[model samples]
Target: MANAQLKEEIIAYSKRIGIDKIGFAAADPFVSFKNRLLEQQQLGFESGFEKGSIEERTNPSTLLPEAKTIISIALAYPSKLKNAPKSKKGDRRGIFCRASWGEDYHHILRRKLQALEEFILTKVEDAKCLSMVDTGELSDRAVAERAGIGWSGKNCAIITPEFGSYVYLGEMITTISIPPDTPIEDQCGTCNKCVEACPTGALVQGGQLDSNKCIAFLTQTKDMLGERYRKKIGNRLYGCDTCQVVCPENKGKDFHHHPEMEPDPDIVKPQLIPLLTISNKEFKRKFGRISGSWRGKKPIQRNAIIALAHYKEKEALPTLFHLLESDPRPVIRGTAAWAIGEFTEKSCEEKLIQAKNREKDPNVLYEIDKALKNKEFDKIQG
Candidate 1:
């Protein structure tokens, strides 16, 4: 098959398989990506992942040595939650930001990409194909931009004119050569809404994204919160979407209701009390496949306590009380003490003092005292 014919066939099949958009890009390595990665490494922005991961990311040859073209695909996440559930009492505001409102995108994207890969091999018997959802050395966003599917916004997300930034990107690295599409011009012109709206200043001036301050990255970190970054966490329990939400391009993209991807009403905006009370077995059963599962139950539990503390709802006092004395994780216990201190009145102060005496962990005691000090409970008791 000719390159043009192959491109047309793949695009047709992609749309048939539920991808909203598909485009082709020449498998040229990203030229400036290496330098950016090096800069991030030196600045201590690279997380637990090794610095070598970045080099592998910039080298298309490492991903697919024989690749001549990249096939980029995007699926639009439902922008509106037509059946939006009520936020629990004392719940913090904010939706799941579409991309994460439903079943895991990785599972959905991979199954579809693998199907596309199978379809391609039937057309070109000897062709080699590799599929990746966000889990490859090659950058899906860069490939999508190069393929003219979208332009990279200052927030480092590829934004389609039709779907805005509410699309999930996937890619196929293949030996099959295809006619590459022309790149799109940057359409984000002079707009700084995404940058200015960032709660943690993660998106520093212009298009530079410092992952160190990124809420999305922080959400995926392990049990311990970094000292400097914890104060900026706000009430976010999972990924952050302030940039995408504030983008003018994403305006009016609300109320998407795809049945296949719809979030479980119970799971969407879950009650903090339930999270604090859930056992590890239940946690595995509930969140095993979601991106939030990467760090296991402990971090999610810890984050729930932090969010509860920030909410400062007196209603959450009972939940915090139960967690303070019995939670297995010391981090969760400490934060629960802090939450109790923040919300419970002097009426609850005696109970807190009793809990503080029984609390074996030093961190929990420290936070208890800190919370009491902040509330002037020490002066009252004195």
Candidate 2:
């Protein structure tokens, strides 16, 4: 009964500290989750981005030996960007996903968890606590699910009743046992909207995801995007929101609870051409605060070139030609070759041929050859 009172105090204090939602969970091993993860690994569905081994991921005891409860918190982010900029003809712009819109959630959630840890220390002097954000071994989604923060939507997002699936989740494991909240009932029902709406079909069979096919994951890749996914990636610069955006539960669900979570229209939807030429210092100065810049500028630049091709911006041809001839990175040179080939320019074939002759790297040469083929096909169609 004393633990129950502590739970109430924690929940109340959490709200006072700007935590949008909080829930308690018993520090038990996620037995079924471990098996499911193993299955995902066996079926090659795992994204290389996961942080820990299966055992460490599913076992809370490994984090804190005397762990008795896990406290999960969620902070909602806005789905709709207010006064979003237009992506017009000569000034086409690429997009960073909604999750990357604001100041990085990792920092925000970490600070909140730290505050909660300090509060808990005051209540129970002997309590041992460990907290982590997305980078931590424990799965944020799994912890949120068990703690009843929200149901796991078909898109693999934790869908809270008040906030939809746009919430950032964090957790703290503690030796002090708190009463666990009942898990929210799965409400996805028979609707497969997210699966059907996914452009790359990354959401395989509802909640399970094949991250390789996920455009969100592909956008963060430093290597050239797979040829098959290039056209489908569209104008996405950082991540894909097709699954979440199409969720019926998320319809008309927009929140601006945290000021820091708000997006700057021009930054998130910046003109694509300037992105290709941004200096490292300039990129840091402008995008340094957002979550999208974590992977550095190379991938974003590559995707921007692909976005230009997707838009078929004829005005960008001159700049693309410059990148094809001079970019130091092979991925950039190769992607530029691919985008140039995608264009209907008559000189594209000749330019690709010249690049192929000068390019010593086999991969870049292959890209050039592929572009030349595209040029021939484009000419035939014309």
Candidate 3:
């Protein structure tokens, strides 16, 4: 009875602290999730960024010995950018996905989870709790699913009825045994929108994702993007929302409940060329607060190179030449070599030839070779 009263008080406190949705679940082992994760590993589909081993991820008890209940929270973020800057022909802008639009969700969710944890301690002195956001050993999606926070959608995102898939999920495991809430019913019946709209068909089927083909995962990778996916990524600087953007459930689901969750028009969609020359300190100062910047500026810059190439912006030729000649990163130099070829200019050949002499990395050399071949091919076609 006392625990039941504590649950109500905790829920009230959660709302006051700005948690959009809260749910409770038993701290039982996530049997199905473990099986799914093992299957993903077997198929080489798991994202390498996943935290902890399979054993540690699936069992909440391993994380907290006295754990009895898992408290799940979701904070809704804005789906639309207000007064977003346009990407014109010459001045193309790269975009970070809606999830990366605002303040790093990890920080936002952690604060809310901590508040709930404190409230729990206030009621139960001996109460023990462990909280984590996306980085924790426990799967935030699995905990949210079990706690009735939302249903796992076809895009492999937890889709809340209120916030669609635009909500950030986090959880807490507590010694206080609150009764578990029933899981939400799956509403993805007969919906194949997200799967079909996937750029690389990364959403193989339903909830299964091949991380290698996932543009969101690809965007975070520091190395060169695969040649086939180069054009497919378009101007995405960080993360891909193609799957979520195409979901029918997310239709007209824009939410602006939190100020910090709102996007800065200039930051989320910055000019592509400026990003190429942005210094390390400047990049951090501008992008440090957002989740997309977690992978650092390299991947974003690499994507910007790809975006510039996709645009075939003749204006970017000088910047591309500079990157090929001086950038320390092989991916940047290689991608710039490719981007230079995209521009049909006489100096492109000479610039690439100059870079070829200086370039030592086999991959960069190979890209330069490919670029030259493409130019030759274009000449033959012309």
Candidate 1 lDDT by residue in tens digits, 1-382: 7878877888888878888888888887787767876776787766554323775677766777788888888888866655556655666432233566677888888988999999999999998888887867677788899999899999889989888998889999898888889888999999988889888888877677788678887776665565456656666668887888888898987534345676665564566767878887898787665565667777777777677666665677777788777877778777777666665377657767887788888877887777666646766666
Best by lDDT: 2
Tens-digit lDDT string for candidate 2 (174-268): 99988899999999999999999989878888889998899999999999899999999899999988888888888889999899999999999
lDDT of each: 0.75, 0.91, 0.91
Please say which candidate is ahead in lDDT: 1 or 3: 3
Q: Looking at model 3, how many pairs of residues clash? A: 0
Scored against the true structure, residue 289 in model 3 reaches a CA lDDT of 94
Q: After superposition, how far is residue 184 of candidate 1 from its true place, in Å?
A: 1.2
- Could you give candidate 3's per-residue lDDT for residues 1-382 as a string of tens digits? 4778888998999889898899999999999999999999999998799988999999989999978999999998898888988899888899999999889999988888888888788789898999999999998889999999999998999999888999899999998999789999999999899999999989999999999999999999988888999999999999999988898889999989888888888999999999999999999999999999998999999999999888888788888899999988898999998888777787898888888888889999999998888755478458
Write down the lDDT that model 1 would get.
Answer: 0.75
**How accurate locally is residue 358 in candidate 3, as Cα lDDT from 0 to 100?**
80
Quote the positional error of residue 12 for candidate 1 in Å.
Answer: 1.0
